[model samples]
Target: MVFQNISTNTKLYVRKGNINIEVKKKATGDRIRRSLGLEDTLSNQALALSIQNLIEKDLSINAFDASLDKYIDKCIKVTETPDDLINLTSLWHKYIEFKRKYWSPTTYANSGLVFAKRFSKLKNQDLRFPQKIQQELFENFSLDAVKRSCIQIKAAINWGLQERIISNVKWTIPNKAFEQLLKRQKEENDINPFSNQERDRIIEAFKTDCFAREKGRHSQYYFAIHFWFLTGCRTGELLGLQWQDIKAGYLTFCRVRSQTNVGEVTKNSLKQQHSRKFPINQQLSNLLVSIPKSKDYVFVNKVGKPISFSSLITCWKRVLSCLQIEYKRPYQCRHTFITDCLKTGKLSPSEVAKLVGTSPAMIYKHYLGAPENIDVPEL
Candidate 1:
């Protein structure tokens, strides 16, 4: 076989009757040679030249490792394989870049930031081995973190597959695995709703700003704190509420305002739904009617700005601590509402779910059933 020089640093020659391409890195003075495993025919010569051209292009950008790995990966066959065209980290960055424009700044900060940081732990790992990812998530992260990271990883992988950045394989974590992860998370972070007595005392404390260094008794955010329990709105949704949302004995929830790295961003929908409307009962109506409509927002701070969740959290913690009530997150306000509704036996899980912008499955799974309180009839 005749030896041929394709470029200054690359040459194709025959070794043992098979075509081989050799590359010499000028900067590192390193020599690399790969066998094309083709016979010394005219067709094989053409293929060798083509491969040489690709290597030259990749070497220009100092990406020899990536370039050669992809070529070799394509040539090989195995039961399970690693994709060298893109790794898990690169896929996540590309997927997030493609999705950034579609996501709200808040969504990007809350989800995009967290997922990106956590995924970095699996640096340069191929997406083909989902079990490795599952193991890392379960062993290294908290149960809730593991669940959320798994969800984000799966979403990014699905996007990568659709975009052709990932090779088609059994790369997805199975549904049973996800269900088990969720079960473990639920066990770790079970819903601990405040009892009716505890709920009432907490509300009263917030209303009076009890144990506050600066007292604004029933003046600052009393209505909002009360509203959280009565309507089961999320803290971000309550902060995003406008007076226009209330009309005709119903409140429309279609926006969320939350802090992000950039700043506060407004999303035109609930976290999971596009919108949800909560009916106003007599008690809810009284609370809404009594609050003065001086500001655009139905709930605002003493200085007439949208209430910050951080401030709300500080107040909630203070009230719970001072009142000697067991500490539950402010989010438990929603749990208490859901539990109370389910306990009444009047509202079905689906009805309660719609009112709270959640799923019936979530209601049934987290909230304990009323039968725990009711006496069983003798058979």
Candidate 2:
């Protein structure tokens, strides 16, 4: 059976055992058809008729949506939703499928992959009960890991609720519990930049292959290490650099290369800003001129491919270990540069923040703290 609203240019019918609606705009002469997600049943016919009436009323006022987005969720059956048996691992995968498009490669690498791995541990635990999740997390993981898992699980479950995926599950990890856990973890927000002497030692170690002489691998990233100290750009932004990004008077710091499951992919743009130009001084110009043009990338590994963050960190740790310098991760090169710029009193916090592609607020918050050693002035 078919129901037609001739005056409104609308038709309601069943095709392939599913109810559908077709609307034609009289002014534009465009036809729009959509599946209503309802099985063919006598009771569903009445509901479809009511929806037709609503669409006709909306059309009369020129308020009908041509895309049919407003009606898409009306047919979601609450009784068909996932129940208490749904596990965190399966639900997390579904949530990722819904959200993966909007995330950057860096976000996926840093947060998404870590959350997915942690959530995989709860494959047998039901997602609907907070007690089970809390127990599993605490029993299997460390305190820090449990806290992180709770935060991420809450976020995922909230997203699932908003999307109508798990309608039966209302219980979530409590906020009071999270606050209690947070209180137990001591916060460490102080900046740990390398000293000038240590920085020079690490750079020389990489340049001369002081650590990996037999493998001859550390020397290939010598230019990369030097560039990080000089410019203070993030690892992804530095790795994304191509020969073309170098201008005559300035270098363009744009784009980011982050590693994902498939391979290395470029993320959108630099954080907080689209792109910025770094003025090329004589020192930077000399460094650029010295590097041989082996590939399109200004930096490459021994095999002449773009440098991956993992590979860079592997070389970084080896160099720092060989030099007997305290290990601060590769990002300290950026911190070291920013701290040195501020300590010189040559640039204000705003200037240092601009040079490092960050905000002055961050500089004041994290970088403005007193150094580890400050000698008292003679009065």
Candidate that scores best on lDDT: 2
Which digits, one per residue and each the tens of the lDDT, describe model 1 over residues 138-241? 78777667767767778888887787767663556655666765665563375788899998887787777667778773348688878989988887788888
What is the TM-score of candidate 1?
A: 0.68
Tell me each candidate's RMSD, in Å, in order.
15.5, 16.5
With candidate 2 superimposed using the best TM-score fit, by how many Å does residue 36's alpha carbon deviate from the native?
A: 32
- Candidate 2 yields a Cα-based lDDT of 0.74
lDDT of 2 by residue, 1-379 (tens): 3443445568777899999988865733798888887786533544455456557767878887777666444323312335545566556656665666877655654566556655644534466577877888788888777777777778888887787777677665666776676674342343588989999899888888878856658888889999999999988889898998998999998888876543467865887789978888898898899887865789988788877778778888878887888788788888899999989988999998988899998888677765755567899
RMSD to native, candidate 1: 15.5
Lowest lDDT block of 10, candidate 2: 72-81
TM-score of each: 0.68, 0.69
Top of the candidates by TM-score:
2
